[model samples]
Target: MDTLTSTSANTWPIISNIIGWTYFLSWSCSFYPQTILNFKRKSVQGLSIDFLYYNVFGFLCYSIFNLAFFFSEDVQDEYRRRHQDSDNLVRANDVLFAVHAFLISFLTLSQTFIFKSDQKLSVTAKTFLLTFIVFILTAIGAVFTEYIKWIDVLYFLSYIKLLISFIKYIPQLWMNYRRKSTIGWSIHNILLDLSGGILSVAQLVLDAAISGDWSGITGDPVKFGLGFVAIVFDLLFMSQHYIFYRERYDFYLAVDDSERQALLPTEQS
Candidate 1:
């Protein structure tokens, strides 16, 4: 059965590769909407500062994890030894996506300094920032002391990324609620994020199904959980933009005198 499943999984590489790259494109493209929006408006006024910081940091850790796992044979061998797996689950597209995401997230963070914006990271975000720094340092110390392998550090970093991704949306959601607007925060970003997230989860499930190894999904749920959390948050963001705060967003960005007048009177009240 294992041999049969392995052969089946080998045959599925082409299809899985296609789906993997599709999600990569979806996720990589998702970053551009907000980047372009910031440039177009010449401001990051309505964008959440905390979101940018958390996103960049999360992707930084994720990039390290993915790149190490993909390129470091040591990590791969350790992974297989740890999991007793024959196939290497790390894909080139995964590494590319993570690196690209980190670069893009960093680019957005740069805009916060370059663009017109008075917003600063909130107290909660600051705490998280410090925690991430300490976590990385501690992991490095463990690696130096030979208490943990580099592969173990990479695994820890990946898990940290998952946690960061899961919580990163909260500040943005709260910011939008407080401001009652999603102006500088592009709705297109949310839509693309939702698509990417859904596709990511689909890819994982497809890979697991083909390999007949439910272990990755059942045993290692970080990636799956992050994807699921992103989808949920994206829906909430959609609601904020299209339902809950729609009128406020429209009114806030309504520059034309006629357009401003066309907004619901309740917005003015």
Candidate 2:
């Protein structure tokens, strides 16, 4: 079998690995700030629930899909193992799936509660009803396992949700770009996003070089185009915040000290 390779073949993997690691670390490091903000604010006041809701749903879908894919891979691995086929590939896939799935699942699930806490009663009521319906549908599909391919439905929903998320972010990106500021943006997230963007483009380029087409990197140019633009502007936004609007980034620290100070009433007294 011949694989058309890129000069970036070895480099791309290292880059991709680095990108993934940075993403994971960024999110992990950011958790404390976001958690403290929500805790002290007692609200998700300035956050966009639309972003959180779609992401949470998407992560839930991805987690479920990961389990399904892992099971399938395990079955294939078991058969191959008996036949003395290479176990290395299977092991690699298992580790990859476990890491990606667990990180996404944990982040989404944890953030969901934080956002939920901040939602208004009316908003919360609506979200709960919608989530309940999705759960019920998913449960019914689980019950009729063979006939109902609930995972597929969830995957489709996730796809749609990501589409909607991009759409939502588009206007925000444009508005921010035009204004040349990221007034209310999260610097940590923007920084992570900027890095993710470059890595994503590299991944796409590498994939295209390998396959001689843009098949696996992303679905199509339209989707890829949207992602590209979003990422580019996100980098710009992050740069603006880092260079010009450093004060807002302190929103994270302020939340932390406020919480700390609250806990020690005698210190003020």
Off-target runs (Cα >4 Å) in candidate 2 are 1-3, 6-33, 36-44, 74-151, 167-185, 211-213, 218-269
> What C-alpha lDDT values do all the predictions have?
0.80, 0.47
After superposition of all CA atoms, the RMSD between model 1 and the true structure is 3.2
* Global lDDT of model 1: 0.80
Which digits, one per residue and each the tens of the lDDT, describe model 1 over residues 117-194? 788778988998899789888998999999999977877787888889888988889878876767678888888888
Off by over 4 Å in 1: 1-11, 218-220, 248-269
TM-score of each model, paired residue for residue: 0.87, 0.51
**Candidate 2 structure quality by residue, lDDT tens digits, 1-269:** 23355565677556545644554454334434444555555444344544454445544543454444345665445434443452211123223433553465355436547556444324643564377458657765774877545434433543543454354454445544454445334566666555545544554554455445434343323224434754766766666667753443323234577765663442222
The 10-residue segment with the lowest total lDDT in model 2: 86-95
* Model 2 C-alpha lDDT versus the unseen true structure: 0.47
